[model samples]
Target: MMEAININHFNRHKITEADIIRRILSGEKELYEILVRRNNQKLYRVIRSYLNDEAEIEDIMQNSYIKGFTKLYQFKLEASFSTWLIRIAINEALARLKEKGKLYHISERAEELNKNTILEIPDKKQLNPQDKMIHHEAKQLLEKAIDQLEPKYKIVYMMKEIEGMSLKETALALDLTLSNVKVRLHRSKEMLKDSLFVISHDTHIFEFGFSRCDRITERVMENI
Candidate 1:
């Protein structure tokens, strides 16, 4: 019983990203699976924002993981491992977009988009859904609204709101200025508020299911 308890304790102790990177770099390549599983959901949403096709998104995901794995030695700890990984994924998605001649109309016109972008998050406590159906409907409406936003704003919003990235991290991943990230996030929130006309917060958009997660990780492991 004591030996079993020690084994359970060792397994339960979480591995930090830096530690995992070190292990993978030191020849324990299987440890890369930990990083893949940890960031799969965020990577899916980030890449999906650029490409709508499910198959293409999965392809970009697998490619991004393989790219990051090969370039792991170049990773600097100045940013979180997740942020570094997000940067790679975003670059991969944008490359795929450019190749397909569907590059977004991303401009540096923060000044133009900033106009009337100062909408408030209105009191949403009154609009809470009481049941699952209402919640699902509200979520769907919110997602449709987000889908309508410009790429610049949508990416900022996904990184900040959906993935819970810090402002600095989002800026780093998107290669936008800190001020740009803030302005675009504000505009994105306002757009959602205007489109939904009620609640402005829904945490269920662009869900990456377990099956897809396993599939992407498996492909990456096989290729790596």
Candidate 2:
């Protein structure tokens, strides 16, 4: 199949992050699109976990990318490019939160959104169209509960649970110790389980669409 050949070709001609970095540093600035497209979804989720407003999230992302590109010369080859970019985005999001006086310390933000509400568990055996609608509603409720968490725990939970990042990667992005990341994630999970009765894995929360990715790429390219 043509798809098979294309896959083989891509594998054979694969580009490493270091190679792309070198080319961009050598003045092929447009190649920055490669980085933006690759990391857009992860970075979007990272910023969204902190701020609820979509416009604010996008503004933070734009600022982060511009900051990253300007500081590209300072990047060390020792760290993965994705990891480095994630750290930059996280810092920008926190800084914006602070500027708006919306920031709270981890301890302060951990004050319970709701301490004693028991949630109803959805039955799993049902596969009818009605069940599907209920499933969708359940997912929305889960997302709402997650959004109520403190930013520290929210970021940790989203990174580990939704974005599939390893504990080490989550710690690196947030500049927390491994133990701290684990503690926050554990507490976050407990909060969700207590509030939702069950976490839904059937739907993605806070997805970044292809149109927005393309728009972000275009905007970053123009600014750089």
Best by TM-score: 2
Which residue segments of model 2 deviate by more than 4 Å? 1-13, 105-129, 194-203
Q: What is the Cα-based lDDT of residue 219 in candidate 1?
A: 92
Q: Which digits, one per residue and each the tens of the lDDT, describe model 1 over residues 166-224? A: 89989988888999999988888776656353454455678899898878888998988
Instruction: TM-score each candidate.
Output: 0.81, 0.83
TM-score of candidate 2 on Cα atoms, chains taken together = 0.83
What's model 1's TM-score? 0.81
Q: Tell me the lDDT of model 2 at 92.
A: 86
Instruction: Encode model 2's per-residue lDDT on 93-144: one tens digit a residue.
Output: 8888799887774544356656566666566588788877776787777788
Give the C-alpha miss distance for residue 222 in model 2, angstroms: 1.2
* Cα distance off (Å), candidate 1, residue 100: 1.3
* Model 2 Cα shift for residue 88 (angstroms): 1.3
Model 1: lowest-lDDT 10 consecutive positions: 107-116
Candidate with the greatest lDDT versus the true structure = 2
- The lDDT per prediction is 0.76, 0.79
